[model samples]
Target: MPCAPTLAHYWLAETLRLREALWGPLEDSGEVRRARAQGQGFGQKVLLRAQFLGQREKLDLLIARWTRGARLALLGMLAAAILAGAATAVGALGDGSRSVNVLLALTAMLGLNALAFLFWLLSFAVRSAGSGTWLGELWLWLTRKLARGPDAALAPRALVEVLSRNNALRWILGGISHGLWAAALLSMLLSLLAVLSARRYGFNWETTLLSADTFVSLTAFLGWLPSLLGFAIPPEAVVRASNGLQALPETAQALWSSWLIGCVATYGLLPRMLCLVLSLLMARRNLAAIGLDENLPGYAELRGRLAPPSEKAGIDGPDTPGFQAHFRPRAPAPHDQTQPLLAGIELAPDTPWPPAGLPAGVADLGIIDSRLERKNLLERFQRQPPGQLLMVCDAQQTPDRGTIALLAELAGLAGQAHIALHGQAGAGFSDARAAAWQERLAAAGFLPGQLHAGLAPALAWLAAGQPARPIAKDAHVQP
Candidate 1:
């Protein structure tokens, strides 16, 4: 079997996808680009994206809360069942009454259970009956009530959807229903034993419409199954005599008591026990088959984004030694007192230029896409270094050696330098792509927390007029 963490991660991933369908899509944090670059499967990409956005942690907490609620609900149901069984037993056999109504006692013990079991069997023939059981639905309703919060509903909804998609919900719920009934029956049997042992009682039957002979035949018929299992059965004479107010002999009383106990055990408790076991086995088999349905709306939408058509490959140029740049560590420049500058390198044409709402006195170098543009920017910076420099790069493009080299030379001349990876206009950057840029720039001598996936945070850092704060690794700036 797979480990718990693996199963949990899968569940969280699927839950997030379902949430998107129900609520809306989450903010992009570059997970798609990274997953695409890594060539991960659809499910793996969803998991990767969820981790990048920090949804996994939130979803995990939700699952934990729901699990705790479910446990409490189960305990409450068990207590209720136990109490119900004890009451049934007590009511069926009165407190040392004149004579026990044998028929009444049998009906009280098994009537409802028998009716429910018959319905459970009939459910197999009905298509919609497998959706859920009454006890299971009650348990879920109680669990939801116990787990109160804004997102409490999401976890249970996702769980039901996943299970139902696999045709496993009915079996799982059936098992729970059967188990609860078994507990009730077992409780009834125990209560019966305790009451019968403490006091002496006589079992008899009385009726206005039925004759004494009919009662005798009914008693013998009911006792037949128990007799096969070594339980004592009263003789015809004892059954006929018990119809009157007079009590039977001690041996006859013992036989009647044995008959009642045997009937309850064989008819009520035994069937429930067997059904519980069968339901559990079926539930386990169905649960093992649970998996994400790829055809769902959320998953279907990601197919194009995460797994685009493959491009034909060809040699772009002859192989050559890799271009490696070495840099000497330079002392920190006093950029806090100088004006900050913002610029873009090889940004897509559709990307919004000179991003709106620039801070006062900040310089915008626009998009630098050519060698001449690069040369001019580097020389300009060398002559008059800005206090803070914000370099925005297109996250949609792969980070190559040339881009890394250009960023390195520019940073060496600035007072304080930071990089911002932006996606296409109106789109969000890929988290994996931003990480790739971070790693490449780190090797180029930029410090950690110097890379930003969103333009807003990078701009905020540029305008702060202080040393950069250590931004969260997975943080994304909203457009």
Candidate 2:
């Protein structure tokens, strides 16, 4: 797996592609224009571009753009950190008193920040703010600069219902937030040290309502770890002397300063640094899990272009006129149905699993993709096959030769089969892809009545098993 920074850089690159994908199939190049002219859709064009750029080139491009965006954000953060350090320095030691109240000065400098960190921890646990992460506003600005509006909706489809749906993106932003906090805390600590060196500043502690004993207990608690690290811890005498009732002697001032430094190191700087490291490790793990989601509409649509199966003419009859199929999205068929085995073959990215339309006994074989999954499905077919295997597929995906080949193979394995086109139907149908699927199925010896929209219709048709043609011997295979 790549390191945290490397993964973060790639995330920016993926975001760039996803943003451009929102623009749909538009292209300025003559080659792209020609591809579009030849009935190649917007998605296939994007895949080709990705291929042309190559993986290494894509990484390089992402690094360049990621660095530019990082630099802008870093510069802004640096300004904020410097300003904060300067303000806190002046606030901490600017008093003309020979001895500064250690409690009062440190609290003034770190109290609000500690409170803010606590609130941050609360928000992290809840994770309710997906799109509004700590750096979300900055990320949004960078997005707008990279492209125009990531429009509210894409009609037939949308970009992961907006970028926030990308969990990987949110995790990356979390790591970035940890890094920013670390920078701010470390800067504040360094600035405080620098200010102290410039003048003879005395540090003391004084609280009005609290007695000397109260502070003694508190100091002992706060300094336990610091003391273990060999840092000096003030005794009860020092705590009593800093009760704001009396000015401490010169020697006591140095002891108070050492105690204050120890508290800041243990409570402030070290914690932030530790959190930052943990965040980076988590970010790396998440990045390593991200893969090109081929199930997405964008990638699904490119099936034909990416893996066009070998042309074995007549495998599916040539005369299919167009890609349109006899499929439309309809109300879910009524529920009184004998359960047919359900299997989804790369259904659309948005299609819900354990499909909504089926009956109770429906066994979902999952979306078929990898060789292992295919092997499992085949094994199940032999183990306990259904009357009819309802193979679900995304209509938006062009039923390319490779797709048809798989469908044909699966159909041969089951006793009986049908194809349920999930996404592309009715108003959203694509003529070219639909026609291709129809011709392929026809040649594969699969017929209508054998076909339906989803589990709902497939079950309904099976329950009503009407005046239909008897299946060919080849159509009903032995398990």
lDDT of each: 0.73, 0.55
Error of 1 at 473 (Å): 23
Top candidate, metric TM-score: 1
Look at candidate 1 and give me any clashing residue pairs: 30-430, 30-431, 31-431
What would you estimate as the lDDT of candidate 2? 0.55
Write the residue-wise lDDT of candidate 2 on 35-62 in tens digits: 3333244444444444332231343344
Q: What lDDT is obtained when candidate 1 is compared to the true structure? A: 0.73
What RMSD, rounded to one decimal, does every model reach?
13.4, 20.1
Best by lDDT: 1
The local lDDT score (0 to 100) that residue 266 gets in candidate 2 is: 72
lDDT of 1 by residue, 1-479 (tens): 12222545556666676666665665341345444544347766655665543342266788778988898899899899999998999889989866888888999889998988887787887877353366877887788788777767877777777677666777777777877888888899899889989988878888999998898788889888888888777888898888857868888888888888889888888887897788788777877776656677777776766675753333322222223322223455654437678999899888888987777788888999887787678767655766678999887777877677677667756666888877743344555665677777776667776777568778888888555554455654345
